[model samples]
Target: MLSPNLLAWSVELFIKEPGSNKTVFWHQDITYWGMGETDDEVTAWIALSDVSVKAGCMRFIPGSHKGGIVDHEDTFSADNLLSRGQEIGGIDESQAVHSPLKPGEMSLHHGRCFHASGANRSDDRRIGLAIRYVTPEVCDQAPGRDWAMPLRGEAPAGGWSCIAGPRGLFHAADLALYDSIIEGQTATLAAGAEQDVSMYGGTKA
Candidate 1:
């Protein structure tokens, strides 16, 4: 449901180790993204392995995005997969819908959707690649600069700079760029967060 010529805000890999107790608490994608409330963003979650209920597949509340952004309490628990451990309270678990995906399958959700995943109890790992896409119209309202990789359209004029694609996997230059991105993005994501944000300081492998 996005427009043509989309740029990716970020592409992150979500990995839930087997028997891990880490959970993704219910929250919206746009809450801490530094982008103000808007429906101009979407995330494509592509499963790299089987994601079943036992493997902690994502569960979404039907039509919850219609209510727009809601308040989230950040628990900052070590067991939470989210950077802030954000959770929206008072959710009716009975209305939740589980999204199970097989290898190579995917699911797309709006930025404002209320979604979360439980702990993995399966024997195998659950992995998914999340691609956050944003329309050119969406701008970062928080502080500092933001980056985007041009995927399928004209380059944006401002608000986001184009990050270069990797020349080779694990290349030194590419790794340096990733470090710079995490350094800059940490400020935006950690803005207004009350607890220690050391989790955002790590460089991607």
Candidate 2:
């Protein structure tokens, strides 16, 4: 589990919203939280703008989180591990949520939620930021120079910080419940108020 350090978040594909009919393709984020037995994972998907269906807002199959992760194929080759059009044989496309998002607002869901995005037809950038959280009980299986962070143990409350560690990694079951007990640790540590990054934005939503 990621507690203090391995809080993985991605800014997005830096999307190209040229017009409609451009697809985001289909793929699942199963590789992040361990493949099958990964546990206690939560994610927050934030749209940087007033996202809409035409602007390529997120789409989620309502309640798809409960179904667990379905196998998926790479729909977009730009960010895929394989070449484009590679029909991945696991994603649960039939139950995907075409859920749309709003700027400043975010959607929190299980790591396994069935979701994806579409091509943006509107004349705006369809940018998104996704943040994921894991308890200090799930260790990452992949390794080597990939940049991992340890999220637990004794650390300063937050002043001009740069989490120092050996490539940033937590022992999963060893890290203390620092995140759970810290409460408003982020806000309290900020020089002034918070930036909504408490959950990634620096402040609480």
Candidate 3:
């Protein structure tokens, strides 16, 4: 399991050009959270495969979290997450250390950490499981806007509410599914969880 106490988690695979996954961009995680400060979140990244710097591993900015969350940029590219911060003097990339791990290993990071991954220059896919954790204190931002919406099922004791604020990000294919859920075409999150009952990292665990 990734984090026994996951607030949100996903199982994802990264597949880029064959042996050309070396180029990478940088970005912060708080950009996905429509509400609350970056200082209010945390993440646990668990690798399901052997991850190396040369194989598109991730690195972290030294104490960048202390600077608080930077204002998010609208660009959709991930390659700029690293170079942009360095070019703008907001981060020192040279000081970062490439952190690698074996399968079943995990990296726990402060939500505000300045992090980036190398390109997936390898021939194989980069596989990992990630879990985003929160203290149940942060408000949801997926109510309105171009972000996620609410499913019109049974509401909580307080009535139907959002678990995240509107975030202008999506995986394209998943956006339509999300929108449908918002329009009462889906079930509640708790109900979905009960149906699948996945672990913190989207694995059976």
lDDT per residue, candidate 1, 1-205, as tens digits? 5878788888878888889887888989888888988888899999999999999999999898888689999888778788887889999999999999999999999989999999889999898899889988788874238888878778777788687688997999989888878777777788899986644311111
Instruction: Give the worst 10-residue stretch by lDDT in candidate 3.
Output: 196-205
Any idea what lDDT model 1 has?
0.83
- In candidate 2, residue 156 scores what lDDT? 25
Best by lDDT: 1
Largest TM-score belongs to which candidate? Answer: 1
Name the TM-score of candidate 2: 0.55
Global lDDT scores for all candidate models? 0.83, 0.46, 0.49
Q: How do these models rank on TM-score, best leading?
A: 1, 3, 2
**Residue range 30-98, candidate 2, lDDT tens digits:** 432332446455677777876788876656656645655565433434332212322335556676656
- lDDT (Cα, tens digit) per residue for candidate 3, span 44-70: 778777777656777888787777667
Ranked by lDDT, the better of candidates 1 and 2 is: 1
lDDT of 3 at 201: 16
For model 3 the local lDDT of residue 3 reads: 24
Per-candidate TM-scores read 0.92, 0.55, 0.58
- Model 2 CA lDDT for position 191: 19
